[model samples]
Target: MQLEPDDSQSDRPVPSLAAPEFAAGDRVRMNALGRSRHPRYGERQAVVVRKVAANGWRVLFEGRTSLLTIHRDYLEKVEPV
Candidate 1:
């Protein structure tokens, strides 16, 4: 999904938070915090293999590759590394 800046305020750019820091080859667990029709597998744990775009991160989970291109605001840092 393309992230378009809000048109209500043309003078100001779309405010965005800093992206979370997760390197490739890092293990991560993603939780479903919102409603969507993407998949019904619930929360999942996966390994970060590569980053596709500025806001898109590709993960390898259960021998399958899934693309999670989420906004930076929705992600939270986890411990237990």
Candidate 2:
């Protein structure tokens, strides 16, 4: 099922026009430097399962079946550590 944008945000933000960054199975980390922490920040370290759109991506945490749709701006590629 697709998610609906929050009604509280009356001024809808424009979607990014850039190309999708991460591919399926790519690992990513949330950029929490300037942005506020997400309610599900615990899943910041996740693997990209698919691209939702040019500006959105679907990611899944290790051992979790449910995937979350996250904005591209909030995500950064994770290098092997």
Count the clashes in each prediction: 0, 0
- My TM-score estimates for the predictions, one after another, are 0.51, 0.63
lDDT of 2 by residue, 1-81 (tens): 999877887544334466338889899877753135565564457899988755788988667789988888777788887
Candidate 2 lDDT at 21 equals 84
Global Cα RMSD, each model: 7.3, 7.5
Candidate 2, TM-score vs. the true structure? Answer: 0.63
Report how far off residue 1 is in candidate 2 (Å): 41
Model 1 residue runs over 4 Å out of place are: 1-16, 34-39, 63-78
| Candidate 1 structure quality by residue, lDDT tens digits, 1-81 | 999876878643233555466777776655443113225433555666676667656666555555655433333334665
| Top of the candidates by lDDT | 2
lDDT of predicted model 2? 0.72
Candidate 1 least-lDDT 10 residues: 33-42
